[model samples]
Target chain A: MSTAKDTAGEDMPWDEVTPEAARKLLVAAVEAFAEQGYHATTTRDIAGRAGMSPAALYIHYKTKEELLHRISRIGHEKALEVLSGAAGIEGTPSERLAEAVSSFVRWHAGRHNTARVVQYELDALSDEHRTEIVELRRRSDAVVREILREGVESGEFDVPDVPGTTLAVLSLCIDVARWFNTQGRRTPDEVGALYADLVLRMVTAQK
Target chain B: MSTAKDTAGEDMPWDEVTPEAARKLLVAAVEAFAEQGYHATTTRDIAGRAGMSPAALYIHYKTKEELLHRISRIGHEKALEVLSGAAGIEGTPSERLAEAVSSFVRWHAGRHNTARVVQYELDALSDEHRTEIVELRRRSDAVVREILREGVESGEFDVPDVPGTTLAVLSLCIDVARWFNTQGRRTPDEVGALYADLVLRMVTAQK
Candidate 1:
């Protein structure tokens, strides 16, 4: 970790990576994995995309799985930040939940190329890495579940099942990565807005 | 189609593949594709799994892509049947919508391996085949959207965005294939019931 700072500024701590070159390689890996699934993509392909020799890829990522780990870790962190940011905002539960869904969905749609690789390729991770990533996902789920619990408690929402709805909401947002296309009629913002209103209807008390 | 019945008694169209040998190859392909992915799973591996020679495999399916197409086609046809059946049921729009989600989610959870390969591996299909599957998917979406429209007209629901909610609802159910595991705490029935209620909440006037 110190070596990274000794050579380059300490912007982040991944698998002890975040250098500009490492970051470029990681982005290339994400594109390769997204375009042609994790198992199908080769290290040679990733290195080739980044315009780096195959040997240079190993200087940063020990293996292709490591590259996937870094991408998934970063993606989950962004997802958590988006959800928790909305959940922590100063607003009613309905407002906050809408904010959470809209922003989270927006990220999934806008960064769908990376999100697709991160969200869909969990099975490709090593057992230990997958466990760690699952922990991150569990926490992400908790963020939304807590919002639903509060909504139910405040009598602001009529949710019959908090955990169930939480799963549905997260599933709903994650799926935008699977289907959203840049050329499609709905832009990320439109989808985000549409989901926010639909989610509000899912929870808010009837007038 | 008649060839199927001439050789083997036609009990069912898709879920029931004709002859024992053909069924084994399809099941083997589903497992291989799910485990290693469509792009990585070789025809030899699929044939090996089915305990057949590679030459024998071609008699039933022309290529690995054809196997994927068959699995995807049958899976989607079944999905359409479930949604259309639920929509055609005698009930309120809310009841029908709930039934549709419940059954769809149940299939995704119970047959998660096949569902995972089918729903997630669309990009691997040939363009002509994918277009056909997309048509099936479009019809499936229309089933749900039609129900939502009926709910709005009947004043049974208060959705501000019918088309948007339809997309969210399908996305919510399809994602069950991604996260659900039979060995996990929840059973297919449990998930189906939970989604049914949550979906009702999404559409119906909040009570």
Candidate 2:
């Protein structure tokens, strides 16, 4: 309900904002939202965390929900960036799928707060924003599903239920945020590699 | 800080506090916590949902945190109940693991609200209660890790990292609550079976 336009500065670009300011604000927003529930977090908290005035934040975004929308959108786009980069690689189904899974796990482990806010806090978004985020999430899921389907059709995997299998794979990656931390015995790379192996085996054709 | 006093008609044993009543209150607590969050849900909200007066609710439990504690404890205990029952039964590693995974997924699906509240709302608990719940969660994680470790030791599986692999397996099960619904494409049973198979394949030893 807190609109951002109530607080924009004269320095804001007409058509787009600067990447550095947006990134700084997004990082601060992610931390605040992760620490406080989306509904409980105020635009002031994000602005304070970013060391900027509320007016400066408003200058960059029109609404608090708009900031959340941007955060969710960026998270989804980053995931797509990882998956899209892996899509064209030349490899067997298992290899390509493992790479995709590895990328996802690493991305999640490194940017856990962002991932958590995006995945768990979307329910707090406006209906339109929620729909947009959900669609982005669907596309992300589809990337994994398409890989699994390709593996099945190519005789590299033998999953009986394509959609469920897709869910299983993504769930394994998305849940890293719930438990992964620097204090854990395994590094992000270690966990990512192990998950990649686990997922590959899950879908690969049984010997 | 709502507390429930044991006042089961003077002569009843503590353990005899009727599962129906306890379950009713537990379900109500789960719903209230899920909808309004742990910090926001009051004993009265749960009591209202369970069609009971606050005094009657207090007769069964001590503290709102205790209610959360009980819900989490019971949920983990239920998981251990299934695991302990299935333990030592004669089967291949994949078969046994599949049964375990199925039980976990099915339990979470059936207790989705409890699962969500326990997993997502721990931040609202006091430190002592939170520590207690964390221990319970760790014990549950230990059960799955033991299974994976035994599989690896017996050459039934070949995981390089036991802890991460165990976390990955549990992650797959835990994330089900976030997405599973009665209106979902697959019934809980179907999802359970698919996930069980997928998990089994993930950890089964290569031929």
Compose the digit string of candidate 2's lDDT tens values, residues A22-129: 756766777777775676678888999989999988878888888888878877888788876775589877888988888888878766776777878777789998
lDDT of 2 by residue, B48-120 (tens): 9989999988888878888888776666666677665554467766667888788788867766766777788
- Cα lDDT tens digits, model 1, A96-190, are 99999999999888778778888888989999999999999999999999988898899999888788788888888999988887778898889
Each candidate's lDDT (Cα)? 0.83, 0.74
Model 1, stretches more than 4 Å misplaced? A1-17, B1-15
Candidate 1 lands at a TM-score of 0.90
